[model samples]
Target: MAAGLAVTLATMTMGACSGERSEFDTRNESFLNDASPDAPAPGPGCGHQCSLDGRSVINTCTGETVQTCAADLACGAGVCQPPCAAAAADKSSNGCDFYFQEPRFEYTTISQSCYAAYVVNTSMQPVEVSMELEGKPLDLSRALYRAEPGSAEMTPLVGPIPPGESAILFISDKSPDTPLTPLESAYLGCPEGVVPASYVGGTPWGTGYGVAFHLTTNAPVSLAAVFPFGGASSAYSSATLLLPVPTWAKQHMIVNAWEMFRDGFGPGAQIFAAEDDTEVTIVPSRPIQSGKGVTGAPARVPVTYHLDKGQLLQIAQNEELTGSLVSSTKPTAIVGGHACANVPTHVTTCDVLAQQIPALEQWGHEYVGVGYAPRMGGEDELMMYRIIAARDGTRLDYDPALPAGAPVTMSAGEHVSFPAGVGEAFVVRTQDADHPIYLAAYMPGHGAAGGIWTGSDGRGDPDFVNVVPAGQYMSSYSFYADPTFADTSLVLVRAKTNGEFKDVSLECAGTLTDWKPVGTRGDYEFTRVILSRNYRPGDSFDGGGTCQYGLQRTKSDGPFTATIWGTAYCVSYGYTGGMALRKLVEIPLDVPH
Candidate 1:
């Protein structure tokens, strides 16, 4: 998950559910504390020791150690208690203690026709989990399989899963052995046209697209969706995405576009409306290079569409949609990337790259744009960043500042892009929150001297990714590498002067190299974690490799941002390379006491 960013509150109602309820409360409520004015103040001679464990704080003062309440509880005047249970008899001297609820999970891509869903139990206790299809719960006992992390096999999940394990679920045309019961079909609005096996050249979910689902568990879990592409005989170009939490959704969004991997081919946008009866408006900031209705000219028109709960809209276009704006009456989820993109126009191979876009409201004013390792032969990689404004008159301030003539003013729905120096990291910020803006980074291909460079006439397609905002920076995150990628690298960022790196930890299913500070932008510092089959403890290559697969988890003492970069060779050789940034599922913040 990216870190927690401040959000404006807008009250909305959700229907209740039957059966076992989730242990977590989805409601956003505030807590109040009553502190006595006569409370004694600490004396100069009084020494204090304080530390945080999860959401709880441990403080040693006046020769005694006391643990404060969990994050959701209220601690005031040195007394800790659940905000609503201050007067309850269960209250104890240590505070009204309780377990923190598991965070809610929100997935943007779910289709029985093309993909499979996996959930990892990230907590210490066993948990029973269930699925909700389009807001309706399914039989918790049906269609569930469990597997250990990194395992290739799955068995029926007949009972609660133990800690540190995971499970898989599917959605598709029901089979005789895994038939969709009439009740389940009704809830999913199934029996639609089955996706043909030849769809997307026989990819896993090619012809049989199914309904999206929401998973609920008794404990926090990590969610992911995997799409195997490049035909059934060859699942070469596969893509994996980390599911986001619904609470992170906002009403506004902007996605950058690039030339299709091939000249005639274009990129596709998979948009999912997270809420019911949602009205979504998609405005094209630029014209479509190629598509059914597209002429040779650009299409600068806006299109509005409606979605029933759980419905998905897939749009493919040849021209770039960089400045496009997506606004919904309610929160929505979006996954945008090319089906396959050729980096340098001359290269014959291409890879799939897609990521869940965070809502615009989650966008922050400050950001540090970082790049992946330089291409082989020390060839400089070009980095381009786009700043999208959420409101009119938003002003941008840059460090290593923009070239003298770059524009600084951005109007709502408008976006501006500037080139970042080769192998350089830079910081950009807005004047205040009133002018929140989203930032995106792009790496251009074309004789770039890397794993997979393709282009024609010196023109190549660029890889675009949403840069994590400083406000959304988190202290911890868990992400997986595309099993199909030959090489992968994890980029980490933090305040340049912060020595919290000593508190940082990185664990991978495979080997993980030590952290190396790669660059700095203003007061922000950056580092890279190399993960590859050929990486050795003392290796100093430019972060490249093969078969870089597995889950990677990271944690640090202070707020920081991280993203994964993966690349492969030409498509003819069965390699398609691209990168996807991960967004964090936040732990709810404790109210101020």
Candidate 2:
């Protein structure tokens, strides 16, 4: 995941040591007077050690302070500057006494081309045994073939440990059946040269954290794990991953997996799929920092494992034995827009509108403005407008009359409107590209002047009013009123794209006397809200006219726990701009407050 630079805290400014015998030496002198176990000389890679006021201060690789008092004081804020504890039953003595700390795991869904290779904190601590991938109910004693045609299982195998341990396991079709698919190995590919292998664990959750065998802190650590079997491969494989981190973690962490082959050939292959068979589990642990405090060590803790693959073949295989795919899955949604919108209705307030707009779901689709020939007055006629929907290098659908142009890719539910007279109103009757845009103009602005082009969904460009058309005075119109007037005739002109013009002339022949005000011509309008509490599956609401900020429900930290959700805004749209009005758009604050 991308992140801003982290500001490191200033190192504990080494204050002058108070000349008193440090805590460790002063208290242990009397016991040592009787002669017990002789303190072993610090190891070769041991960090800096100093005595501070009767305590042993050890500065680990990460600059963290570790204080050990001679069987008395507590380690406070990484330092041993304290009075010693006299009683033996005190938990304070046990607090920071551990000679070594375990590694921190940043649980993440398995990567597209990478299998689970947890970071092991080998520095300072003894790590002799490596981590292994274990499986549950469905025995993975041997590498299991994923139901996904040619994919093999990809699981982790732990090996002898040491400081700074990090490794990955490869399970191919030829390997014995284990729980996970070999999708990761297929993409990552086997190394060109010899690499050490290790033992595989067979626990269900073991697929992620895998079983880790701790090494003796005093011995030389080996770089590999014990793989029970070896073999060749007929097909490729990818690893499964967990969707998100554990609920308890505070910061948001993301796992990025890219393909790396023997020759560094091929572009990053398509890594995502929309089905359930490809779902992978992500296990979480503290972030791994090499040489840092024992945070990189693989943890042997219990974690929840729920099968959630999207690839259809894997889904079937998981279900054949694990029961229904739904039964084996967890109730968490993926992070992408489309994936977020697809989370089961039971778990979240899925954006029904976002689902309808492809652009909102993916970035590849864009809302691009095309050719725009400003009309001096009425030189241009027949303003052409069209919308094209494309995906995966293919035009799924498009407007037949729109000229060649760029596409206005927007979220599924996002709506854009062109000025009246830019072209005939094409209402978005449905999710079809051929559908005409919807238009709506209020009374007085009724008919052609009040005309609007919109979709059947009720979304459209602003209604055209006070059209100077051909021979009318300009002073009678408020450029702010009929803002589209300044839009001229063509804001966009292109072939095969969802492009539109900002300026255009409206087709209005009504006499001046017949004109009427479209409601109150003011920035302030009575803001009405529907479904403020319980909205139907696909329900939506919109606004237009002088209003810049449309009505929107307040967002919540989590789904369905909204104590209140309604129009909460600033002087401008969502509190950003500087515009203010005596009577601004407001909604019923009575959102069950």
Using TM-score as the measure, which candidate wins? 1
User: On residues 265-381, what C-alpha lDDT tens digit does candidate 2 reach at each position?
Assistant: 100101112223433232222222222111222222212232222211110001001000111122222211110110111111111000001011111111111111212122122
What TM-score, over all chains together, does every model reach?
0.61, 0.20
lDDT (C-alpha) at residue 428 in model 1: 63
RMSD of each: 14.2, 29.8
Give the Å shift of residue 239 in candidate 2: 12
Least well predicted 10-residue stretch by lDDT in candidate 2: 570-579
- TM-score (C-alpha) between model 2 and the true structure: 0.20
lDDT of each: 0.43, 0.18
